[model samples]
Target chain A: TQLLEQSPQFLSIQEGENLTVYCNSSSVFSSLQWYRQEPGEGPVLLVTVVTGGEVKKLKRLTFQFGDARKDSSLHITAAQPGDTGLYLCAGTQTGANNLFFGTGTRLTVIP
Target chain B: DAGITQSPRHKVTETGTPVTLRCHQTENHRYMYWYRQDPGHGLRLIHYSYGVKDTDKGEVSDGYSVSRSKTEDFLLTLESATSSQTSVYFCAISELDNTEAFFGQGTRLTVV
Candidate 1:
């Protein structure tokens, strides 16, 4: 069973548009990370969030950890064609070493 | 990009045959993991190793076994291949918990 769930399994948008993807779980997490995967390649790490309600920005990409530590969100502003890929969220629960990955969101940005 | 490499990027085998996938890392990271990706199921952990000769089973361990005889190498074996096992397998390595994981390009396996 998948411990984490992600919303908007698929998204398609034009260039300069905005989009948000969500990852949620019932179990609390100690830390959560975001990754982006392109075709024929492995997922690359984007950012890691450790604090609840804390937000981090990577250029036009913004990531936020839920205040309850059971959810997270990723927002991309001015989406570009280069932003098209699969977005994944992984979390490590307290006292656990195995990383539980969430269902992925595939984003397609058309130019 | 993190000096992690997976061999046999693509493979096709018949059912009931045995296959092994190799994951090699030059970074000497302590943690290595094997994951299989399928539609809707996302990425499911098959097995993982924390050090040489120290390994553990993950969520989907059926018909799968792993060996880590050396720090730089982790191997996953399928005793007998099946059509249900066909999926893209990924290798990930990390030096510590709560840190970034470096993944290999992934191996596309097909069982016919």
Candidate 2:
């Protein structure tokens, strides 16, 4: 059973378009993280959100943590071909050492 | 770039055969994890180690076992390979429980 669920299992968009990916769960978490992975490589950490209702921006990418700490979202503005890859969300429950991951979203940005 | 290496990047084995995957880290991180990635399941934890000789089962540990005899090495073993176990396996290391984790390139395993 997957603790977290992500929306839009796959996405494809043209260059300069926008897209958003969502990760949701019933259980609250102490922290949430987003990762991006390309083909044949390991997933790399993109950002971490610790507080509820907090939003962080990284150039063209924006990440937001839900107020209840049970959900998160990643939005990319003006998607580029280079942004094509898999996006995964992970969370650690309060007082728990184990990390749980979502189903994942595979994004493809066409030029 | 976190000094993590997974041996036998790709392997193919027959059903019921035993296989072992090695994950070595030079960072000396205290936490190590093994995860398997499949089509719809995404990434599921197989096993994890918190310290030398300390290991625990994860959500999908039915067909997998792990050993951490040393501080820098974590090993994942399949007592009997099965087709359902075929997937890409990843190894990750972290300094703390909730902090950022560094992952290995991943090993592709096939059970025929």
Candidate 3:
């Protein structure tokens, strides 16, 4: 079984603050995806990192995949109240098409 | 949006009763999955279907059963509802690989 572990289960910070979330796993993955879910709604796709050591940015959000393909990170710069949501990382194993999701990180940005 | 819809958005049933949830997709995707989400636990797969009449068990598939007779519909049934089965259920659809999966709004079930 593949297990993904996310750090900082809950985070609260004032607006304009910078925060980072980490997702680590013991097994290597072919691809990693990040999702943000609001209260009472399903998760929505944010980004996908396929290559090891790859970095992708979406406006104020930056995502990075580890060189070993076993870890990933999401960094938000100058966070705003709209950035508050539950962040989840899912990893697809080398040969499987299913994804194993991390525990998730609930972030709250206060204005 | 992925054009995915789940029926019975919220339901309350007693133990030992049979309940079925429906998932309908218009995306024409070949893969469909059923997942359960609980507090502190992100999401656990209950069952998945690769194609019509082709279904497989997922990580957590003990008390759940699924059927897919058409490409646009999938049904998940609970033989006998239990208190522990009370959770938010989500249906997802994907094409070919695991690139980007589209999820439904989810159905919240309560077993008393």
Candidate 4:
């Protein structure tokens, strides 16, 4: 069983549309992070949320950490073709050495 | 991107053959990790090394082994390759000061 579950395994939308992806878990985490992976490339870190109820924005991307630290969400505004890629959410448990990653959500934006 | 390199960027090996993938880092970070990415699975950790001669398993450790003999290099070996093992593998390094990790380009392995 996956410790973290991400919804909308795949998404296809037109450019300029908005979309949101979610990651949920039953266990609380000390820190959570989001990453984007493109074809033929390794995943790159997008943002990290450490505190519960924290919100971070990177240009057109917005990330939110749940108050209980058990869930998180990513919202994209006016999505563009360049934003298409696999989105992954990972969480690090307290006193743990490895981060648990969620099944990714593949997004495709057509211009 | 941090100075991390994965060898054999692309490989095609037969099943039951032994394959070793190497990860070299110039950052000399204390932590090194191996992860595989698949269609449904985003990125599952196979193994990680904390320091020289120190290693541990991750969520997906079966059918794989890792060794860290030096501070700058980590090796992942598959004793017997399987078709299911065909995937893109990534190497990452992390420092003690922060949780942010730097990932290598990746190695695409195919088992026939």
State the C-alpha lDDT per candidate. Answer: 0.94, 0.94, 0.93, 0.93
Correct interface contacts retained, every candidate: 0.75, 0.78, 0.62, 0.65
Give the poorly placed runs of model 2, Cα more than 4 Å off. Answer: none
Q: Tens digit of lDDT per residue, candidate 1, span A4-93?
A: 999899999999999999999999999999999999999899999999998999999999999999999999999999999999999998
Report residue A38 deviation for candidate 3 (angstroms). Answer: 0.8
User: Clashing residue pairs, candidate 3?
Assistant: none
Identify the superior model by TM-score, candidate 1 or candidate 2: 1
User: Mind giving the per-residue lDDT tens digits that candidate 3 earns over B1-112?
Assistant: 8899999999999999999999999999999999999877888889999999999998899999999999999999999999999999999999975668888999999999
Q: Model 2 chain B, poorest ten-residue lDDT window? A: B96-105
What is the Å distance of residue A15 in model 2 from its true position? Answer: 0.4
Instruction: TM-score for candidate 4, please give it.
Output: 0.96
DockQ class, candidate 1: medium
Categorize the docking of model 4: medium
What DockQ does each listed candidate score? 0.80, 0.82, 0.69, 0.63
lDDT of 4 at B100: 82
How well does each candidate superpose onto the true structure, as a TM-score?
0.98, 0.98, 0.98, 0.96
lDDT of 1 by residue, B1-108 (tens): 799889899999999999999999999999999999999988888999988999988889999999999999999999999999999999999998547899999999
TM-score of chain A of each: 0.98, 0.98, 0.97, 0.98
Q: In model 3, which runs have C-alpha deviations exceeding 4 angstroms? A: none
